[model samples]
Target: MSDVQVRGARLEDEAAIREIADQEMAAQEALDPRFGFRPDASGRYSVYLRERIRDLDSVVFVAEVGGAVVGVAIGTIRKQESLFELRRFGYISDLMVKPAARRLGVGRALYDRLLTWFRGLGVRVARMHVAARSDEARAFWKSVGAEPWLTESWVDVPAADGPPDPAGSEAKPAPKRAAGGYAGDLPDDDPSPAGMADASDDDTDTDDDTDTDAGDEATAGEPTSTRGADE
Candidate 1:
């Protein structure tokens, strides 16, 4: 391999970085089915990198060999708020090196440059998330003195009977509709006369009747209110 140079990324390096990212993503997904590496059909990854390059808190670095980029690292400085303290930390969002560049110290060079940038920003704590099945990534992190603190898990739910919705698993309960057809618990001033009457009657009945009657009414109206809020 030619001399490897690691430095901050620039706009002209966009294409090279994107290609390396795609290559690494494909290789990771091949290694672990749970990676769920979706191809960037819309060029969103490049756009994201471009945006990050211009962000004050973000740092992007690339490693070049023989005048060609072979590795990349993207990171950011984040303000972390906790019960006991507020502090700034560095987050490694991505780190990738070409297959031919592995075991050649390219990844280490990129990480060291990123760490330097973080230190310049006065950040002491750095963190990154690695896939459980990615042994290579875990080993690299450990080599850099990083320790795991959390584990993440995912579940894939199939569509019941129609086309798959990308957000199906995150579907929320529908909001309840008010008597006035309003979706939320909005102010009563805008309610229709009939809705107001119904609300008033319900309130009065709840105050005067058995608790069972109030519970039943609440159960009957719950769905409508939920659906309304969702809308």
Candidate 2:
């Protein structure tokens, strides 16, 4: 077993971090073609990491064995407000373990340190989005005691035939169905919506947007680049 040590990431770790991120992205693309992730040709992922390392609300940690970084985990604490209450939770935005170092506890070490950090900040729950097709990730999270609480689905709406006029009349709202109507279940004949060519469902939650100084944006499913680390 490798003697893995986890610590906060530094500026010097950018190169290795980018390499791992690129590999993760490649694996994601293979798993789902619709995963829309593209790093610039000039290695823009490093720039992205640089910003992340500087964010106060975000935490980035790297796992090292024998003085070489083998894995990374990034997370952020975000405040959420609803009509009932306001609370904060931790979101694991990105995690990657080099192919050779995986299954050697590097990824787990990274995650453990991240969870510790989250707890230190009074975060009670940590959330992450795994790719829908990544069985490895699903099993890993389940083993770690994470449960699936929601499913995210997407549908693309085609553009209108003509541009909207500035003085156009307001659109009417769809009719509201009465409560407890129609057996409260979908019909078995046609489960899909009319005129919709494709619909996709992703159960895992991942952040696809770039990390900002304020905090990381929360996304619904894991992007292709970060899927490999879930193993």
Please provide TM-scores, in order, for all candidate models, with all chains considered together. Answer: 0.65, 0.69
State the local distance difference test value for candidate 1.
0.48
lDDT at position 71, candidate 2: 73
Strongest candidate by TM-score: 2
Worst 10 residues of 2 by lDDT: 191-200
Give the C-alpha miss distance for residue 81 in model 2, angstroms.
2.1
Q: Which candidate comes out best when scored by lDDT?
A: 2
**Minimal lDDT window, size 10, model 1:** 222-231
Mind giving the per-residue lDDT tens digits that candidate 2 earns over 180-213? 2222111232111110000011112232222111
Model 1 over residues 19-43: C-alpha lDDT tens digits?
7656555554564555453454217
Compared to the true structure, candidate 2 yields what TM-score?
0.69
